[model samples]
Target: MSTAGPDCPQKWCTGGACDGARLDSLLTEEARWLWEQLAARADRSGEPSMTGGTAVITAPAASTQRAAVLGLLGSRPLAPGERRRIRLEELTLRLRQHGERLTPGAVAAHAAGRALGSTAAERARQIARTTGLRKLRARLAGALPKNARLRPSEEAWQELHRTGRVARVLQHPQPEQLLKTAAEVLRLLPPQGRVDRRLLAFKAAGDPHGLDAGTDLAGLVLAEAAAAGLTTSGMPPRTAWGALGVDLDRLGGGLLSLGVHPDGWLVPARFPLPLPPATLADVSWPAPPHEAPGCS
Candidate 1:
């Protein structure tokens, strides 16, 4: 009997053609919806026009003054019947004060820069709103278990649900998943003690790299740890790790300066005798540890 493999299925042999077509269709639908929404919100007040009205210059007729007036006139298109009476000398003087040249190119560039800045500000606002909402949901969910008696009002719950529905349309993950992961991570820590960072990562996330430096999970863990007073800013990295029972190798400790000056000077400054109490306070004399001078 001839031993030969059966012919490959046509669907498998197509090599992602079907998947690509489906993805393209989805993207086109999303783009159509976005365009429709934008169009519905677009301003349709007036038709755009170049030089809506005539420019009357009131300054002394000079070559530079005429150039400045023409530059300003043609920098942007004027609206319908929008006549501008400009004193070319005053305009040029103000431009100089602002370190900008009184030229058409400079005016156009400034306008373009302002437009880009406005777009960037809008995008930043959108991102801030999304991030704030996500954090708010996470915080509320985290507190719900501890404050079982404290429940959200019906109106507030409905509003949150409506907002979450909109967020779902934007393809963001549900807040429940974030709360679940955070709860699991928090459970790894003892009520009155600390646990090894790496061990906790392995147990909670099943990945040694879950809490690695620069990771979002690491930032979240560290922030929660600090909030709970499990870690302190004064602790060096090694001490911080050791406090959590995490063993890190090839990690350097904080540096100390001893008997050395960057300017190569080692002489002690001589002060006049019989210093006043204010001067003593300035030098922090006899202050208790962790307490500032001039405080009881």
Candidate 2:
């Protein structure tokens, strides 16, 4: 019954030392596949697999800074640490996808409100003094889609979870509320057309802190315009949708169900609605005739 020789140590092979060379040759196809999966995961996460342990991807300072800056503006008093952690990763994914790299850190002294190194203090003031949302919006500009459109929040959120194991349903807009939001978009259209879509969206969404570009409301506002067939050239549909306020990956399917095109415009459907210039009599037609008293 003894068949071992060159590869076998003495009479019997022990542990992995003797069979190491033949291990690959001995593996079943399924085992190889499982190993491949584990290897791929390790490659992606920059960490190797362990016996029963799990990997935890720490949030980079850039994402953490972004979260704190935004939270300072207005998040649930203080979001749960776990929630913030998830958001950090989400922000990292979003930024990376857009062809930008952000290393985290706020000016140490500025974070503490003091002066330090010749330029460090100034740099801190520049980056950390977020009196407005301008900087954040600029960062997300490149990551936006070239041709975006809006759909119902429900439709978008459902599409967002179609495949992912870790699914999220962000900013679910109400039917009635969004219908009115659509009306608001229409109401704000200038005679010449082409409003600063993002700015208008931020104002309407009431996020004075800033329109986190990837967020739902930001995309929804622009999507509403696309749905109205008022979207002009320039800007991706997906980007517009995200800015308008939703980021549904498959909004087209939902549009089809509603007899609307993926872009939100109806196909072979209703005669175009009249979009006459607003008259003075329609006071409510233009919500807030002027900006708040001293907005200038």
Residue-pair clashes per candidate, as listed? 1, 30
| All-Cα superposition RMSD per candidate | 21.5, 25.1
Residue-by-residue lDDT tens digits, candidate 1, 19-111: 212122212322232222212222121111111222242333344433333433345533433444644344334334333222211222222
True-structure lDDT of candidate 2: 0.33
TM for candidate 2 is 0.20
- Which ranges in model 1 have alpha carbons more than 4 Å from their true place? 1-67, 70-123, 126-183, 227-230, 241-296
Query: TM-score for model 1?
Result: 0.33
RMSD of 2: 25.1
Q: What is the lDDT of residue 2 in candidate 2?
A: 15
Please provide TM-scores, in order, for all candidate models, with all chains considered together: 0.33, 0.20
Task: Quote the positional error of residue 64 for candidate 1 in Å.
Answer: 4.4
